[model samples]
Target: MQIQDLPYSDPGVPDARSGPHLLWWLWRNQLGGQLRSLAWGLLHFVSVSALPFCVGLAIQAVVEESGTDLALTGALMLLCGIGIAVGDTFLHRAAVTNWITAAARVQQLLARKAAHLGSALTRRVAAGEVVAVSTGDVEKIGWFVEALSRFTAAAVTVVVACVGLLVYQPALGVVVAVGLPVVALAALPLLPRATRRADLQREKAGRATELASDTVAGLRVLRGIGGEDLFLDRYRRASQEVRHAAVRSARMWSLISAIQVLLPGLLLIAVVWHGIHLARHGRITVGELVTVYSAVMILSYPLRHFEEIAMAYSFSRPSAKRAARVLSLERPTDAGGSREAGVPRGDLYDPATGLLAAEGLLTAVVCGDPDAAGRLAERLGGHPAEPGVSVLLGGVPLDDLPLDSARTAVLVQDKDPVLLSGTLRELLDVPASGAVSAEDALAAAQCEDVLEALVQGSLEAADPMDARITERGRSLSGGQRQRLALARSLVTDPGVLVLDEPTSAVDSHTEARIADGLRRLRTGRTTVVFTSSPLLLDRADRVALVHEGEVLAVGVHRELVATDPRYRAVVTRETEEDPAPAGADRNLTGQGALLGASDKLAEIEESA
Candidate 1:
């Protein structure tokens, strides 16, 4: 709550009912800081507003030949100067503290939501949208929060000055006071237009950000099909649209800025002209005329705060709405959860699929459909594809267990697992059971070559463990990435590990080695590998063949291969029994090679 006691232990649940409500909640929560800022800001403005009065008194004292009054007026001016400096300095400090704390609070709330939702956050929201909210939108919300107090201080001082003027001098005060309010509220009509334009720009910018994020995430696949240029073109057009919207928004804001300047200048002219008329008509003295002129000039400064406050609100309202919307999202698995964890070691059962992965066994599920396999993998990890249905462990629904509990109980590595950007050591530095060391897991995953590849790719890497992996491991090949992901999963040493197509990208030689190492490393643990690779199938403790959504067969690989045609059909394409002779697969890309060069070279030469 205080400046030094920053980064609240708990940033309290946000009032995400709406954007305006969230802003109000933040204001009320940060009341202490806001009040401090307002007090200092009020002092600063009051001192500034006092300067013209002291100047007018000095003029009047000089006109009346009063030396004592003049001296006292000069002393008061010095005191006001001191007040101005001290108040201004502390006002800025408080505002900045409030700004930073407000931003930090929002960040903490967002991070908590992300952790609570886990991977489901991305399933519900776009990665780019979340990025925008956490980065750009946070600053906007904080700006509006800090600006509120300053604007209030400025408004209060202006009103006090107007009342003082009305009592001291009627004719000139009536003209100046009425005109100032009109000038302050002059930009109201244009605000809705400016807000609309700004919202359009932000919306387009968010879309452009989403496009760029998606393009970068899939840059590998895009390059594979030679479609990177096409995506690049799309992103370029989206960026252009954002640029145009920004220009339009800027144009509207510029018009508002012009009005703020132009209207005040016009007010100054009218006040000066009317005051000279009053002085010439013998209604006011020269000193009074000078005082009125000085007051009008001093008061115009605070009017700008009104325009600034409007601009800040216009920009941040949408940002708060976005933050509120993201925070409002709830995970489908959030309600049926509990603190009491289920048994970690048990026979995992998916009632939907009628397949069971018993404890202390390596089970292979040969599902002909990859989509079905992917769904099964998600279910095994408590992320059921369908609503109201969950995989069970030890007669307890996986969804009913606490998030961390379910995670420790079952680890499901997606078929195409991603390696986040970090050092090689960090990639494997997971919350683990400590049963398997990183080095041992790497060996078990046959990642020696992958480690060497990382070391070779970096010029400054003295150790493979220190080598940095690029974002999503784009710098590594598909097989190397799979091996690294496998090693990371192995290091966790969970009670049950589900791997979907763990070695689909690797060759038979590597696949065989990985399968042996996998079985050796997971000797007594529950491991379910969804694979159709014959090399992996032959080593499993049991194989279940799933055809059309039903478990059709369950037996040893050799028995199933000999007795069940469905199981054999699924794994047959991957069976590499006979070896090809040398040069058998060499490309016959040229004319002579296609005609069997050694046998047809002489005949082709004679024909030519």
Candidate 2:
């Protein structure tokens, strides 16, 4: 494929069986580009080699006192020079095209894999490793792929030149033919040592990259805990290790380079010495001697390619292996199941947790363990703890339906929702069934303050929706970001919505308002919320108390508090208080009093 036709229409399924296999697959896919580069390279190297032959012929013509022969030989030299210039120009163009196209193809495959795997990808691989593969690893793979054609052409040119020399003069030809192979093969012993060092360098670099990424991601937390210097020192040590490994790898490569130059230089001296001896014995002509010397000199250029190709393979092998590992990840699927299509319209049920969120009702789950809560939330949305743990919707197994169908049928908003970098309008521009508008969702999520904060520094006429949000909404307060994420999720208005602690960051007052708004907005939809806040639990049509990995009670919030000690303790974090006096307002005491106190503290904090 050419550079212009890049970003393959379909970046077809990759052959991710092994590193070498993946490399070969890439090469096979871009055979057209490779052949074009190879053809141009062949033309260029052959023309360059022919220049010496032309000069040798011209010297012979001049020595024989043949004017016509001299004119013809001079014309041939000029033609060879033109050929060399034209061939070299296009060879470079083709090789660059191959490199760019190969890299683009690999990048497309990686991007496709990322989309297919979604959040599960980060769980399976390090974020920094993914970054390295997409950026640095891709370029190394492309470099090796692009270098292949040139290496092939160089090898061919060396062979053809050796054959021509043997035909022109056997005495000097035998010396060159024997010495060229030795020059090419002499560096083989050093390659394994260099390759091992390169692998070590790559490993150290990956760790350093991952550490830097993690450190940057948690910079705010590190500063809060006065541990920024600790992480910085750790990164510094990691960087030093990377630098030391790189130096060792470079040293090995430098030795190989030195051998490459030294052995070829020795071969050149040997050929010249042998040629001079043949000339003294009258076994070779001056023209033959000049031609042999020029050919050997020309042969040195191609011989260097052996070292280059070896180095390229050494570096790219590990890169390809990493890329293959990432690409090999497949979405977990159920065995012996035929996937059904279309959005599922039904009650959400998780068999593993025995949690049933009835059709068109808000069901809140209070789990004692946050980790278990998160996993249950995933299961409720069809991403189970293990394959075949069925999460069914509308009497259909969620895993037995197509992924796209299951996703459209249920939308899960994690406790720590990510607000991607973009304008407010773009951030909320999710795929929706058009049952809810952005303004309506924003209002329902109590995001007026967030909208105001986003538009604070903008021009007066600028729309709040047009205001920009920083990466992951880092610029916004925790509550504002959470409200914004809630608004984004509400905009989708899926058949079933699974929210894990959607209001955990907000004040009790805001949470109370959000809980009321969420119930009113999702009145006739299946909504499963994993939370312990009494404000949200009180609003749910039914509340499920999850303890020790299973639901122990399912009832109204007040009934569960009175009867289930486990549920009451988990939610209130206290022993059950005596039942409130008859006809007392529920919001005046106990959990309600604490929630009210929290609201008052939040108001005071805001005022301060």
Candidate 3:
């Protein structure tokens, strides 16, 4: 594919079996570009090598005092020079094209994998490693791929030059031919040591990168806890380790480079020494000696390709391995049934926990363990952690449904939902079935305070929807960000909305208003909220107490509090309490309103 056609329209499936295999796959895919680059490289090197031969011929013509031969040789020299200039320029162009296109293809493949796996990608691979692969690692892989053609052409040039030298002068040719292979093979023993050092350096660098990413991500928390210096010290140590490893790796490579230069220099001296001996013996003439010397010098340039190709492979092998590991990750597939056949939509049930969220009701689940709650929430949304486990919707296995269909059918908003950086309108811009408008969703989410906050900050022109939100809504207050996420979820209006701690960051008053608004907005829809807030629990049509791993009690909030001591302790955070009187459920429903009115009056009295 052309470089411009990049980010391939499909980014076709990758062969992620192994690192070497991935590199081979990439090479095969870009054979056209590689061949073009190889052809241009051959032309460039051949023309460069021919320059020495032309000079030798000119010297012979001049020595013989043949005017016609001198003219023809001069003309040949000019043509070789022109060929060198043109070939070198285009060779560079083709090689660069191959490099960029190969990198682009790998980048596209990575991006596609990221999108496919979503949050699961980070779970399988470190965020920093993913970043490294897509950026620096991509370039390294492309470098190896692009260098392949040039290396091939260089090898070919060396072989052809050796053959030409043998034909031109047998004595000097034998010396060069024998010495060239020795020079090339001499460095092979050092490569394994260098490669091992390179791998060590890469490992250290990846850890350092991961440490930096994690530290940055938790900078706010570290500052809050007064642990910034501790983290800084840790990162400093990691950075030092990375630097030490890099220096060590560099030392090995430097030794290899030294060997590369030293061995070639020794070969060059041997060839020159032999050529002089042959000349002294009258076995070769001055023109032939000059030609043999020039050919050996030209051969040195191609010999360096061996070292470069080795270094490239050493660096790129690990990078390709990391990239392949990420690309090999596959989304969880259901072995139960065909998703294309479609499944019914109704009540959401997790057989693992025996938690049933009846259709068209706002079911609240109270769990003592937050982690269990989160896992249960994910399970209810068809993303069970265990294989062969499934969440059923309308008596049909949710996992059996197509990914898009499952997502559309059940929307799960985790406790810590992410808000992408964009304008408020852009943030709310999501694929919806049009059941609710932006204004309605905002109102349902009780986001008037969020809008007012944006307006008061003058973050946008009169319309709060146009206000820009910083990354993950860092500029917004915790409560405001939570409400904005709730509004965004409400807009989708999925059949079953699973919310985990939707109002954990909000005040009781705001949480109360949100609970009421949510119940009203999702009156006829299935909404499963995983929370322990009394305000939200009071409003739930049916409340289930999840103790250990199974549903222990299923009833209204008042009934569960009165009957189950474990449920009461989880919800109220107290072990001892008076049992509610008869008709307490009826009174509690009224108390929800009375509490709201009392809070408002207190606010007004304080203001007055």
Candidate 4:
């Protein structure tokens, strides 16, 4: 379908197997607008063609008859000039409208895809690639869309000009007609090379953008570890590689530009030579010869558009492909309905792992492998697993339920929580409509200080909304961000809350408060917190030790340690100095102070 026929301004269809078909679709859909632009552009170019004839006529009129009625010819020339100016204005306006609208439509489609994919987007695609596609690639695609109409108009103008030349003087016309095609088609030969260079440049640019993004994100950690120089060097290397690729692309474009310039000039010279030969033979007047020369010169304007369209298409095809890739990502689906008899009041189960989290009971999972815990958390939250794992909430398979229903029922608080920039109150506000007061949620998450700080954050301003939070809450400490994220989740009051390390950063006092608050706030709710913290585990009614991808033991925190040596070693950090095993669910547990205390106790006992 043409762009005009698209449901939205930009049709971001992902099935790129039919790129030409889609381009045709866009043409058909926006036919009216395209036609309007074409008509205007044609009128403008035809006006240019008329100018040469008018100049020749005016020159002949001046030489042959001093008192001739030049008024009529002069009036025609003035009118054509006015028409060209007016048509050019409207043509550009229509083209720009099409460009901006089409780009916006694509953006809208991408945004919809992002919303549907949710967290899955990051899992499926690189963050940097998405960033590049949205910003730079989109503009490239828009550039092509805007050029299409004008390009068509330019081609039409060239054809009309060539035909006019043929009718005016056959000998000069043949040269005009033949020479124009050579100039317009000159850029076609270089397209393949140009496109290859553009692709290389885009690829390298994407890599560089990714590296820069990664470096920026990890800048704090790099600085902490005194690896800033190393990361900077890596980024510099990536930047240089991108620069090299860009230079290659520029070189190809420069060659194309040279051809565009040379071919048009050569065509004009050949047409002028033929026109002069015709004039010498008394076949055409000297004024007609001048007109032929003027037409050939005028033809250059539209001929340039031919090269531009080629360049635009070469750049846009890949950009559209990139955009399509993002749009093609499928939203996760559940095969069957999970609507059971009860209101989901039972322990969670994962058939893939043969593990059961008992209902109304706090469960602690100690995994020898941290990745195993993260996978378990993903499963427990009804999130799509990396295959071979299925999570069931209240005997209902999570994947079976609609995504919205599943998410509403189960909340997964990630280890690295994202805090959107907003006021403290705004940040605490969540999906559930007024189920829990902000104050209550804050108290439950033990975030009294957080609120106090926020209130104090904008003490001078009359409104709390005036408080400024930097992007990603960079202004806040990691622990504060974590607590705030927890508070937001608590406010949601989901039936099942799967936390991946809820208190890994806070001091013991705050950790204990948070634990108490969670227990009190999440009363009667199925809450599963993935933590190796003694404080959180002690609060759990039962604990499960995961070993070899299985629940080796399931019991209270104390009982699991008493019975399972591996569980004791894993939780107490007796096996390794590090509290978490290699690749353990990120120490999402904010209760590092409790774990630190546990470590000190173990040291004292070992010394004894």
TM-score, every prediction: 0.87, 0.94, 0.92, 0.86
* Candidate whose lDDT is highest: 2
lDDT of each: 0.86, 0.87, 0.85, 0.75
Better of 2 and 3 by TM-score: 2
Which residue segments of model 1 deviate by more than 4 Å? 1-7, 341-343, 368-372, 544-608
Taking the tens digit of each residue's C-alpha lDDT, what string does model 2 give over 255-322? 99999899888988988898889889998778878888888888788788899999999999999999
What's the TM for model 3? 0.92
Span of 10 residues, lowest total lDDT, candidate 1? 586-595
TM-score of 2: 0.94
lDDT of 4 by residue, 1-608 (tens): 33455456445454444434434544565567777878888888788778987888887787678446466679889989998999889888888777766666667777877866666787788999998988887777778877888888888888888888788878788887777777777778789999999998899889889888888887778888999999889889988988999899999999989998988788777767777777788988887888889888887888889888888888888888888778777645434455633335577887776777677655667776767777678767766645554577776767666667777777888778788876666776568846677677777777776656666766565444456566677766778778888888888877777888889888766786687778888777778888887788877877777788777788887566555667767777765344444444322333344555655654775699
* Candidates ranked by TM-score: 2, 3, 1, 4
Residue-by-residue lDDT tens digits, candidate 3, 1-608: 76666667776777899999989998998899899889988888888888778878888888899999889989988898888788789889888988898889899999988865666678679999999899999999999999999999999998888888889888888888888888888888988998999999899889989999988877778998999999899999999998999999999989988988998888788878888888899988888888888877877787888999999999999999999999998767544346685536778888877999999999999999999898788778776665746888998887677777787888899888889998889998998879899999899788998898777776445889888787888778778889999999999889899999999998876787788789989999999999988788888999998988899999998777767878877876654564335455533544334455545654875699
Model 2 is weakest, by summed lDDT over 10 consecutive residues, at 331-340
Decide which is better by TM-score, 1 or 2. 2
lDDT-sorted candidate list, best first: 2, 1, 3, 4
The TM-score obtained by model 1 is 0.87
